[model samples]
Target: MADPLLVVPVREGTATVSLRLFRTATGDRTAVAFSSPLALARVLGPGQRWIRLSAPALRHMVADLGVTGIVLDPAGTLPPRSPATGHDVHRLRVA
Candidate 1:
């Protein structure tokens, strides 16, 4: 099976973050930074392989996307607050 695509919310302008997933006209999966949950709902109806990302992994993924100045809550459910930086490539393992 193909590896599941990872979607990280890079920018959260409000108390709740919006999620969006889309396939371009040319058939390429694309996600916009700071998108809306309504848009995500429109795309993801059922049987999608979506998963919540750990804090560390989420930081790494966003950095990979060239985002900066991210602040995660210290008391968040995800552990290991240290952000991973200066890596050319990152790999996420899902079980």
Candidate 2:
């Protein structure tokens, strides 16, 4: 059977958007995916932007980047709240 597509979280950079990888408690690099949008939202929140990719595709895309694992339907763990409340800026620098 063909690999099924999964919901993968992504983030935007200064000039391009890319997959958002994760680190385990022990500092292992991993790519997180979800079986469905609902599952993704449950962990990453409703406003998370994502794209569809099969597990195999994700593995290939991240292989060169040192990502060694894929986490499906990861447990939701909200980051500790920061006293500061604002969005971080992302801008491209010109040489």
Clashes of each: 0, 0
For candidate 2, the per-residue lDDT at 1 reads 86
lDDT of each: 0.32, 0.72
**Model 2 lowest lDDT segment of ten:** 86-95
TM-score of each: 0.24, 0.77
Cα lDDT for residue 81, candidate 1: 16
Candidate 2 lDDT tens digits, 1-95: 89999999887657987887777655677778889999878776787779999888999998998876787887754442222642321111111
Q: lDDT tens string, model 1, 1-95?
A: 54333333332324744332223334333332213333333333232223445445545554544443233211111111123541212211111
Choose the strongest candidate by TM-score: 2
Compared with the true structure, the alpha-carbon lDDT of candidate 2 equals 0.72
